[model samples]
Target chain A: MATTSRVARPRLSSTGDALRPDSNGSTRERLTALAFIAPALLGFAVFYFWPTLRGVYFSFTEYDVFNAPVFVGLDNYRALFADATFGNAMLVTVEYVAINIISQTVLALLIAVLLHRVTRSVFVRSIVVMPYLVANVVVALLFYWMLDAQIGITNQFLGWLGIEPVAFFGDQNLAIPTIALVNTWRHVGYTALLLFAGMVMIPHDVYEAGRVDGASEWKMFWRITLPLLRPVLALVLVITVVGSFQAFDTVAVTTAGGPGDASRVIQYYIFDLAFQRLQFGYASAVSVVLFVILAAVALVQLKLMRAGESDVA
Target chain B: MATTAAAPLDTEALLDRSAGGGGRPRRGPGRILAWVALVLIMAATLFPFLWMIRTAFSNGAALSTQPASLLPVEPTLGAFRRVLGLASTEEAQAQGGSGAAIDFGRYLLNSVLVSVLITAGQVFFGALAAYAFARLRWPGRDTVFFLFLTALMVPPIFTQLPNFLLMRDLGLLNTYAAIVLPFFFMTPFAIFFLRQFFLGIPHEVEEAARLDGAGPLRRFFGVILPMASGPITTLAILQYVQAWSEYFWPLLVASEENVRVLTVGLGIFRAQTPQGTPDWSGMMAGTLLAALPVLLLFAVFSRKIVNSIGFSGVK
Candidate 1:
């Protein structure tokens, strides 16, 4: 299974020497390194790089699966702007992302802080994080069963409280928010665990210092904890935003983007267009738009993080 | 102001005493509130799973009743038996009254095979590439690594349409390869994670191996791999859970019965059960079975998994 030649090599002092053009061992070292990385690089090229480029190309063409892709210039983009469902899908996606990020972040921060303060027991921490390991499909299914208007435990509890049993998935207005709630329910544990991990890295001395300064617990949280936790908090925010924008599995299983396209986010819209409607070119165009939005968001996050670091310095 | 001034000194004395005693700090009202909040959150978080267990054990008739019991009145394994294909249709109908036995065993096996292969493939290839990035020197290394990182920012939906078309043209649609190929090799996150770990290894160990006349491959295999086992194991667990939980791609490609993974199979199960009245008991059982493996993995490797999350965040 080994690909490299078994030639004995010199023990170079620094890695920089191995890259020198004048050295006799440089070519062989390069060969060995190339052999080591070839499999993954080859797979990446075939699966990710090539497909991404072709996808960009396809966005500009009018291709169904049946016919060869005919170059249509900007037709797909022009049509995407005019499509009412596409616009609605974008709006719905933004709403979904906003609710999901806000709820998940706030709940996760609360749970993480609580867990960090109360316990160091692995058992308790695992209990909080366990739901995250469960598949999104399973979470969506369980919630679907619980939110079933007629016999769902949620509705039953509401009835006991003298409230009307509202249809979660049946009503267009409640559908996206309901899905967002379920998504948050499924992921908040993970976000909390990640944030908790970050919290653990904050030295105990820092808290003691806050105590020394006569800071209230609330003051310490706002002034010290949140400020010190910026890096991980940014990570959590970016992950939540990216994930919520691409929300698919829960919507697929629960609403199927239903109640009259009320829950149809852009990812599901792309899936429906490509797989169900066979509109490959239009879907590609939408995919490019999605790609641009995500990339821009990531770049902005990186820039903001860098600026934050420099300010701290 | 006097109390606030004394509080820090008191806390310092407490800490010094605890340091000598090697015991935990005293619990206060804050601790009590934290516990109360934790208990409430835990109840909310775990209630769904508890409900799933209740439904899985209850018969279909019990579920249809008004004000469903929090605990099953008459517990039975009939739903589990039917979902696993171990129960006869006649027996299921006799017990639950309108249950159908799905070929869930096949789907379970498919899920296991796909997840294992993808996990193994990703960890192995990711390690190889990470080793190169960490220790080896080659021209254009930084550029190539930058390109790989760029892949992380591209939303997966961007590639789904083209990947589907490519799979169709290659006649790989509906095959397990279709589900496994794109993801099985490596991912940018895995490479970045493993590279950080590999870079932490001391250079002196590899130098000693060189003194013993060991080739680069032998040194890597005999030394670096063993030293990095902790991170490797963490990556394996994380990757396995991720692969098993995958849904969207599998649904897109593995539409055939023979190749269908559990997630897609469950989706189809939900869709196929008559509108407005689903097989709740059986569906609950299916959901339980699907979630059990990752849950078991977490139960065993909870500490390592938690540490891995912390480790990933540090950089």
Candidate 2:
């Protein structure tokens, strides 16, 4: 049906073009697009939009899985503010996000710049992406063994340096950073690929112009590549910050938010509240708070990114 | 834009160094360091997976040996056999925890079934939606499409509990439906991806078919789909890997042994450990085996995986 309409359109357009100068070909275009997009729109509405609205509504109500929600007004919200665990979770999450964005972004930028200078071999690119492909569970489990403190390879390596064994995950102070470092290692390959793509899209003429201007390698990079790469960097920062806030599975697998909640991210905290404590209403309230925090942060970052780009321009 | 191409003296010196390509001045220290850094990154990535494989096979007693061997001294299929339940769930059971009772066979079957259904649904329904979005004209098209994009920002955690409630209300909890239904329909990301590829294709190809009287359905099935094979194949591989590795949702939904996926089964195993110490050997064995499908997928299609991520990230 769409093809028939599409087929009819050109002939119709010619007739319309000849007879009616006002015809814009808009109707045919719209119908054809509607046919293509309807299914996606329907599915998105049911699975995504409706649920998102439902989530927000449920945040204000008290309900268990067995019963319909009973409106409790701002009670859940009040308890959320009063909860000490919630406070700790907020602090830990902010710290985690800060650590993740800084470390991962810096490493990704460095690797991307380095890889850009190297040969653009397919094999090299594949090797660079290999770490990102490994499942989070596998990485967490692997690190668990490697950082086992006594029988672990990390301690064994330290032993050779004649240093005492260090419990990487066992110590409260070391736990979050160790996890953060591992997170950085797993993500840098993936992030580098993003930066590399941005690098490749840069026109060669710009680099050549920089070369002709007697720019040093460092100067050329700072002046030419970094500015061109702004969009990708902004993208990486947005996704990284958002992802850090949502960190759950790795902590679940590795630390179980342990060493007394040192590594407990907001997602993990939410999970414990909803599942373990069975505080469905309170968790919903927490989720609402999280949603607000993320939205504010994203909006601010987006504004900053646009402002920075405009400044560069 | 106009300037000298570096100082003539500097270019001449650099060119001379480049000309001595094989011995003392062949590769600069910079180039060597670059290669070294590349090699180190590769090692860092590969080392954990290698260690997992070795540790999975190493005997518990041998693992405790001083100055532990990186390679298992007596590498055995013992762990693999135990995990596959070709030996006995008893060895696993003796090791104790939720794993002791875990039926690896059931979990494997559950994972395979769920992954297959989700992949099939995403390809079929997602293609239909993507095709519509790509080719068919509609009212409020971009507005509606952007609405779908906003769904990406809602975060999975937001939908997770509500969906579970929906499943519970439907009495589909503890069933595969709970795990599969939310993902079975068209997703915004997949729609956007397929639409991007579809938009790049010239209308002339479809127009030619239309002129030859090929129906819309016929053109879609015979032409558009075949042309869109690369993205479809890539999406399938990704959706499969994702479904196979998913932990939290499955844990939340499926409580029965028969419905348990590998991730939840591992979780149960983790929970069942006696005292403070976990059954490290058994747990590692299970964890390694559980990651096998994704590992295999990654090994086979690292390029596609990376390219897809890059593509999505940029968009």
Candidate 3:
């Protein structure tokens, strides 16, 4: 209990107290803080700040490999809008984000609620968090074999139910779903782990009050649990949305944008242009579009989430 | 209004009757169904991993017989041997021929070296920057910090071409620098994470050290840093796992065999196979090797990693 209190204590008061004039150590203390922070600040500017400036500038130039960038004056942005592949990539990205947002959050919440109620043993807690430890590549590889239609265990199990072997990765309809399912499988555990932490922090007396009122489990969950969980839920949703917009690796590895680029997500498309086709300017323009999309989505989501919190209170 | 007040007396009498009825040996079917549903979901969740372990041990001959065995009727160490390079050509050919010759040991060593160096660099630079951002009074610190945060949402692909150009110009291509340099330095995520942890730490501790006549560097090195060891270690573990698992950036730059990390190497190896029918056994072997560093890190710092995910999101 004391340790929990210590962990929960605010640090501002302590710091304010230390800054009192009679201490005679104020100037030296500030100097020490500055010294500690200098190395990081220097690296941040050179690596992050400078490159960010360069990225914005390069978006307007036509630069292929083996040549200096020449100012193109919005030609790259024009080409991006006119490109068919960009449209397809945009469609694919929407489907991916939509499916992932719904599935990852809902399943994460369900699993979190389930895990929160595990009263039998503490061992369940550790086992529940294990999948998040596995790398994305490993998860991808695992799903690749599992969905291989020929020797895949998923197909083999379906055969037992008298269903024909399905081309999960090959089919246009199945490809996005396959990737979404695999992503959800890998991330659900991690998301649930976070949600469970939120659940754990809720004071026990609130639940007891619901019990005293003879509230049904569903009613209590809807009225009490979810309202209290809005902050963490909102946080996860925003991050997931931004992350889904950047989805590249799993699709790249699983299908390589195959079956005539059926799973050609925007990020992968941008990558092919920059690296494979040497269209650096065009890729940067698409990247800027993606950045705008993500920024807008995040901003709207934050506003709605804040509104939800106010409404609940 | 008088009837509304009198209704409570009638509800009290009914509640007393219902309480007696509720204890009459009846159980809620909803609760029972919820438990059953939970068990089924758990099984569904865990079955894939169980099947993976089973598949890793089975071979081609037994892999496709009438009524294929669920428990590996003729289990063999052949797959593991071929993966680890102990099998002869006959065993290799039986699995999927020359395609499975991934040289897992070499790839394993490469991954370890890259991940370790990247993790060390990320933590060091992240700490320095985080310290500055958290405690230092610098010109335009908040603006610079926000700029770095914007990098987090930029979708790494945006910077790929530019970074590639920069790296090529510097002649860092086809080297460990290609894989490590871009990422081995400070990451915004790490800096943000560490800054939040640092902000949570009390200033009194460092002030107390200063009162002892210790200089700024001494207070930071001796006081704030020691206090931050928990979160610093957590960030290190997260960065290590991410660096070990990174595929795309490394895929873009590390084209040469000499500098190829495991993830890219595996992809290229898979692509070069006959008609793109990737050598399943070898890919699995390569994947297992690639996953070792992350798995080991998790084993060492399971609690810290799990806790960090929550703390990381809090900021």
Candidate 4:
């Protein structure tokens, strides 16, 4: 595949040559390569490899940090299966994920389309993404203050319009939606940029050919843009859904899963079970369940979207 | 570099209006409406964000009085003083801050130290591993790199408890080691990112370095790494932002005051709300302090960041 050509390919275009192992696989070369990868491999084996296996292993055993782990085989899973709190958490997490994915994908699509028309300068692009550049805790605190019922800027502004003050985080019914909205504010810009990337990749000749055939802008968008945009939308959905499931900092800082367990999503539930109640085994079981669900969700989504298939289709 | 605070908006030329035939300009009511709606949306999205800066500069006592004011209420630096621990407890309470101190200056230092160490170590080792994968021919090289990539699919929550117990067993909990070690080593994403770049580099130069009798390490440091300064810088910026803004891992292991990073510090500040009203002004000031480094870095390298935008599903 490398062709043994003298003139190199363009600097960024990827080639499949990596799949072909080098012809000279001498022992000295192998040892040198091993040495090169050793430090990273050490880190990978320790932090990622060992910890992941140990985490799953810990789920089947009972350990209190004070004593050796006692193997309890499926008890943690059985308890979690019947746990109402876990059920509530999963439901709440799904509720949170649904709101976040739909709103973020739609809003980010809007922003990207608009910016594609107006300007795409790095300065303007950077401004839109600035909110996303900070920690979730920053925006969480920011919106938490602005949305405060009593004297928050949002409520104060709403009062000018003669509307009653609404409790965003304080009301159980409003808490989950508010969390989703807050994260949307943080992410919509970045997701817009992500969609914009997908838009930029669509070949110019596709649109040129459309215009030559007298296709209107709206017509072109429907026929050309939306179909091409599907894979990107799927990607943003998977990303936002996964991150939304693990939404912790905002919940931790703003509501702390309060207002009567309305905002107690699964990740927060895992955290509380482990740290607050010191039930490490139950928490690990919950994590395994979450991992499985997330993996299944990702697989289902990729399959449904037919990612990496023809954009025109 | 597709890690966090700001990821590779990795796909370049994000808004290439000129490239598309649909970018045609036409005067119409629909265009006007679209423009107006764009302004409105940008306004609604960005307008509320200014509240943090406005509140940070205002005295805490004035927030209750001027909750909706355009200019800062009783514009003062007292809240910042309160966060930085420059004000005494009496002064803090008198100015509507909690009596407990936040000491953001100390946390800022911790954040800088921690973020730098992570970026430096992660980039260096990640680059090495990436080189091996990209430039060297060896047994199981691709397989090993594929295994490293599998770790990217494992969420931080899945490994949270085991890592915690490992740290506790090693007596490193509440220390910087626990806060740093989990990410201090190579991240799969980091390796993947560097390997992609390393693969793109002209093999001619590396071949010349080899002919000069340079060893593997020498060729790496002397030739390839220097040639990769552009991507390396991009990776470092992305990695630094991620390291600085990390919340979950640090929150789990190093919630103690001294080792606390700015994010966890801000959380604690928010949690310590006084009896009546939350310390809105003081907490906002802390948030500003926490966010400044990342924002400043973005401002400095925004063009570099924007030009390097690639979507690798980094979140």
Worst 10 residues of 2 chain A by lDDT: A7-16
DockQ, prediction 1? 0.34
* Highest-DockQ candidate: 4
lDDT of candidate 2 over A21-94, digit per residue (tens): 44333565455545655655666776777777887888788877456789989888888778888899898888
lDDT of each: 0.77, 0.68, 0.66, 0.78
- Give the per-residue lDDT digits (tens) of candidate 1, residues B53-120: 99889886567674468896468998888877788878776555345547778998999999999998
Question: In terms of docking quality, how is candidate 1 classified?
Answer: acceptable
What overall lDDT, based on C-alpha atoms, would model 1 receive against the true structure? 0.77
Tens digits of per-residue lDDT, candidate 1, A19-127, equal: 3444334676678788889988987898889989999998898877798889999999999879999999999999998898899999999988776655666677788
User: Scoring each candidate complex against the real one, what DockQ results?
Assistant: 0.34, 0.30, 0.32, 0.44
* Residue-wise C-alpha lDDT for candidate 2, range B20-47, written one tens digit per residue: 2211112567678877988887788778
Identify the runs in model 4 with alpha carbons over 4 angstroms from their true place. Answer: A1-24, A307-313, B1-23, B312-314
Best of the candidates, TM-score: 4
Tens-digit lDDT track of model 4 for A1-313:
0110101111222342444455445676678888889998888888878988988888998866567888999999999878999999999999998898789888888878766655565666787778888888899999999999998988988999999999999998999999999998888888887777667766656777786888876787788777877766665566667677788889998999988899999889999988988788778889999888877876686565554344334
The top-ranked prediction according to lDDT is: 4
Model 3 global lDDT (CA atoms, 0 to 1): 0.66
